[model samples]
Target: MPKIPAMTTYDAHPMHDRVVLITGGAQGVGRGIAQAVLGAGGSVMIGDLDKEAGAACLQEWQVGDRAAFRQLDVSRESSVRRWVDAALARFGRIDGLVNNAGIADPLREPLHTLPLEKWNRYINTNLTGAFLCSKYTLPALNKANGAIINIASTRALQSEPDTEAYAASKGGLVALTHAMAVSVGPSVRVNAILPGWIVTDAWQKPQKRHTPKLSRIDHQQHPAGRVGTPEDIGALAVYLLSSAAGFVTGQHFVVDGGMTVKMQYA
Candidate 1:
């Protein structure tokens, strides 16, 4: 099926008056973003490839008329359109969109051994998916003078071995952020945030979820005194979409606990 829906409500929070569309929002980082919006009082139409996760999220936010879920395969143009339509039909209007959909795996295979299908999957889901979501949602966003936050990663700037596909996809998102900021400016703002080491093990669905295994080195390695959280990125997302950052656009923020700035030695 192209789309589906589950509805609820969350009110009188920081984003109390806004309605947003979040992609890949059924688990991990996406789930965090969804919770952030709901916590801030903003309503959301979250989409994801995992139907189980989507169902779970819908049940969790099953309060009133403010929230819903749709199974979305962002890589498919038809799916993207249907998801957007399901949102508009349910919520009446859209105030913002978060292009947070993408495969999270950073495969450790050598470049020579990497399969063509894997590379295509990364590009299609990570880069092309954002393009399609932005293309289809621009009209609604322009109507509301909304914002777009592309969830890039620290890998965009720097990367480890066997991470070429993931890094390239994120880098493309960073580039797309500025390009869209200029193209859709005045009516809509666009920005990208690169999050690093956010421990999302505990944020998954019931069966797959587990306690995070963090160590002293993980906390000490970051300049922020600890690893990052989904809320960190989620909070920035709220700010970027709010009136406070009305003048901000075409910017890239690295929310990596200052890890990118610290010099590393062997």
Candidate 2:
């Protein structure tokens, strides 16, 4: 009989020597993921439309050559292409991509009052942006057998009033995840993370950063007993991008502190 292998402790740097590109990485969830990748001994190239926030991230991280940042408008193909080219130039290869950029505001005018321009804005930034990033990065990702993580929202599965545009955009992102997964499998992996109520007050730019305000009821409402944080999403992202999740693909993982699973009676 063959002897059983001994179990080992978890690796501290599972992403060593890897490089990941994160869109809208200057703040919020994107910033959290970038920090996690760097913490796991991986490099990062952050692309965001906010130049000040991007510079702030670079200054704060101080990871030297292991991290880079560029202003990117993911909704524009030229901007996406430039960002991708810049990343490859700096890191030489791409190991993962995180499509985390989108307008955070969910409240919009009533669907009947919503203008076509407003709806298009959400779709262009949230859905088309991911497509552009993936399209331009696919070649490099394929060569490296990398992964893609789309930062969708729990709104995709559920919605509230005045959230039509945001909900639809996220729902489209969830569908895009599976479609891309099937289209790029065997060489590249694609997945989505639906986050719920993550408090990003402290994850913003220096001028905008502040302590999050929460009430006891807020903490008690979630089955997890607390509101979520950027780190919560970041930790999962690191795992999904690592070899530990090699078998996982074309799936949407909800990291909403069990809020979505709870039944609420009006």
Candidate 3:
């Protein structure tokens, strides 16, 4: 009989020496991913629209040189370009890009009452933002053979009322993930993460941060026996951005505490 191999210790810094660029990384899920990358021994360049939040993150993280913040509006191509340029200049290389910026509000005016401007707002920020970031960072990513992780929503798969615009944007993001995966394969990997019911009340900026008010039903409803957190998504983001996921590409991973797989009745 063959002898069993000795167990190996888990690696604490899977992303050591690497650099990642995260948009909307000043707070919420983006901030969680940023912290995860740092914990994995990677550097981060964070871009967000909220200057105050960005400053707060910088102050709280205290990771000198390893973390940076830039004010960015991902909807604008020029802003995206500058953010990419800054990251490349600061870190000299970008091994990963996390497109985590977007309007998080799902319930808007009803579709019939939703104006075209509001719809455009969703598309421009949520969908086009990813495109612009990908477009600007592709060259650097290609050089490093990096990865792109789009933070799509499970709303793309299942939705509530008054979520048409948000759903469409995330659904488009899902399609974009696969399309880009095929288009840029063998050089840079692209993927999407669909998160559901992640409690971000405590993940916000200083002024906005608060303890999450969750009910027993919220934890019990999920097959995983708990509500999801930003860290849950962060762990997967690290994996998807690492060498271990070399064979994984063009996939949409649902990180929702198994909520999507469970059946529900009215």
For each candidate, the alpha-carbon lDDT, in order, equals 0.90, 0.95, 0.95
In terms of lDDT, model 3 sits at: 0.95
> What would the TM-score be for candidate 2 when compared with the true structure?
0.97
The estimated TM-scores of all candidates read 0.93, 0.97, 0.96
List the RMSD of every prediction in angstroms. 8.5, 1.1, 2.2
User: Model 2 clash pairs?
Assistant: none
Number of clashes recorded per candidate: 4, 0, 0
Off by over 4 Å in 1: 1-12
Error of 3 at 30 (Å): 0.3
Candidate 1 weakest lDDT stretch, 10 residues: 5-14
- Tell me, by TM-score, which candidate is best: 2
Q: For residues 1-266, what per-residue lDDT tens digits would candidate 3 score against the true structure?
A: 99999996677798999999999999999999999999999999999999999999999999899999999999999999999999998989999999999999985568999999999999999999999999999999999999999999999999888899999999999999999999999899999999999999999999999999999999999999999999998999999998888999999999998999998986
Q: Report how far off residue 238 is in candidate 3 (Å).
A: 0.4
Worst 10 residues of 2 by lDDT: 107-116
* lDDT by residue (tens digit), candidate 1, 1-266: 85667563532365777998999998888888888888888898999999999888888777577789999999999999999999999988889899999988877778998999999999999999999999999999999999999999989999899988999999999999999999999999999988898999888888899999999999999989999888888888888877778899999999999999999998
